[model samples]
Target chain A: MSTRTPGTDDGSAPLLTLLPSTPGGAAAPAPERADAARNRRRILDAAARIVAEKGPDAVTMNQVAHASGIGVGTVYRRFGDVSQLLWALLDDRERQFQEAYMSGPPPLGPGAPADERLDAFLDALVDRVAEQRALLLAAHSAAPRARYHSGAYQVMHTHVAMLVSRLRPDADPALLAHLLLAPFSPDLMHHLSVEQALPAERVKAGVRELLALRDRPRPA
Target chain B: MSTRTPGTDDGSAPLLTLLPSTPGGAAAPAPERADAARNRRRILDAAARIVAEKGPDAVTMNQVAHASGIGVGTVYRRFGDVSQLLWALLDDRERQFQEAYMSGPPPLGPGAPADERLDAFLDALVDRVAEQRALLLAAHSAAPRARYHSGAYQVMHTHVAMLVSRLRPDADPALLAHLLLAPFSPDLMHHLSVEQALPAERVKAGVRELLALRDRPRPA
Candidate 1:
């Protein structure tokens, strides 16, 4: 349910994450199983707090269990290991982000013109990457090439490709989409936002400005 | 002479290597020793052939030694290791490329308009990457993040940033340079060219088309 598969159920998203429930959220609430759903929230929340406060490297099963006021055995049984728990945390946040861009509201969602939608998407992407900086960096470094093939990237690429076609029917939408998304790669975002110390607003603005070339005459 | 040092002469490029002696070939000749510069050329030529035909993964010191008809000990002494030899090959080609764009002729060099020069640079970059696909991919995967911090990248970024400033003085040239160069990333090119089987010309054309939005009035 919590795997990285995109465009699927996103595993009953917003069932218990921090995102304000959206239109596409709350897909026919599944019947409660033996796993305690409330306990899952508590555990995930505790792990997220640990990641935010001390970074992912600091999170341990014992710490998460203690922070959640749950037994260590339950933590182990639920997540299997610290890495899995960290991935779960990333998935949780990604699901929320998908909801916002896919169906949350105007500009970001379905109602705005393609140009504003593109702008809104880039802005939201900056915030999303900034919000999950530590987790994304770790994921990126672990499998740097995997970013091009990841579910999140594919979903974002497909979304961007559609918008590029809408914005410029004469352009090569597929390649242009990849070029547009290039700046948002986790490593670049991490470099600009953290290494270079540019604020999220400036980063967002810079990314948007890159698209300002969309209607110029291309050199032959 | 090149060892991947970021921004520090890239270690006096082309003291010895095999590149076609073109119009932009050869900086001021450096002081030479008794060991014929011809010998350095032979060794590098052998390495390049192996890399092209068998891929960089198949390269070895002994193989280069045998292929170059040089002593195995000399190969070790000259390159320090297999990785260093591969880098020398990359730098050899990179130096030629830098020479072409920085001082060779019209569009890619100094004579053309900024916009056309920008297009030429990217076109040549595509050709450069296509020529050294195997080598670049190896170097990139080995140290993916190093691209941002490398001397070659810094030099390229400087060139692109200057062009961007010329084209749009009011724009954020520094950041736009990074965004513009992002599509040339080794990983993405490897994905598109090798993995996706995209023709080099199409990839080059698609990349140039992305800049079509350059002079358009951005949406307020």
Candidate 2:
């Protein structure tokens, strides 16, 4: 792996930060050191491949070390264990996605109207879950109840609740947010996108339709 | 238990019956043996009270035995295990709910417009799940994936799909059915009803609002 930080790298230690006050919105801190960032990258790349080829349960420190051509000692030092390594991998993508919505651009970010932003967020969510179906589903089923407790879920819930509050100030935004997020559950999405072979676009359209009926009856 | 068969009893074995080709409807066969039904009633009544007072996890043969005033040996002989007893409890309610929708009367049954019936069905579902929230949540978390595979889920899916097809012949009834049912997942309902403390009436209203938007836009 290159010892130099990638040009795109801003060096933010996004993963080390726990429980954001604003969840995904205002969370990234200053970047990690160049060598450390590169080591993390090398290790994650190897682990991702192993997860793809063998599955999350099959990933191990030794396998990732052999694949990355990195020292096994360094791998152990970086991730501490296979489970931490897998979470590191999830966190990497999670931060970027959070960044995209929290501050990246209009519609998905802060510049657009609430309804448009909500639509953009749901659309992006379809793609996000689609990107990591197996890994997320396994994680979710392992502790289905923990979905409500996780920092990631809280962040998403906070973000969604904020949007709903803006969209319908008179509505019970907290409950509405949960209702809206229900269809996005990994198990349900697995049934839709994977088992049913629905195109992501159709799922996105269906979600839009589902949300449209939330606060009002259908228009004639 | 009284050995005399009730006049309504038709001598069919309900417990030994397996998966029906059509899920819930047409699955009852004939009425259960009266003495066996009475025994089941006592066992389940005892189990329900224990579940309500403590929780499904707290249920045991001895507690059910003490509450039902039946022998512990009989509880084990009848239900085999706590888990099995809980399922039998669910199935008892499931059969009655199915009967109401399948052959009972107007709106929820046969004589009303499909849309009206759909509305009534969704409303009743809120009540049905709310009735046994703790028991259902325990059973559901134990096998989250199995929700889609269970005979109960299939029966509900079949019923919903039939209604969707009636309401929108050109739409993908099967997929729409799954999408509509996603929110009713026991975990989500628990989060909404128990954790958030939203009342069953509010949940029922919210579901009606949700289904009202099935394929239509919100009324201005």
Return the top candidate by DockQ. Answer: 1
Extract clashing residue pairs from model 1.
A212-B213, A213-B212, A213-B213, A213-B214, A214-B213, A215-B213, A216-B212, B6-B151, B7-B151
lDDT of 2 by residue, B1-220 (tens): 2223321222222321222223243456467789878988999988888777876656666667878989877888888766567777778788889889888898999999888888888888888888888877877777677777778888888998898788767567777788788888899999888888989888876676544332354347
Give the 10-residue window scoring lowest on summed lDDT in candidate 2 chain A: A7-16
* Candidate of highest lDDT: 1
Off by over 4 Å in 2: A1-31, A213-220, B1-32, B211-220
DockQ list for all candidates: 0.41, 0.30
True contacts kept of each: 0.59, 0.36
Error of 1 at B150 (Å): 0.7
Pairs clashing in candidate 2? A11-A31, A12-A31
| Alpha-carbon deviation at A168 in model 2, angstroms | 2.6
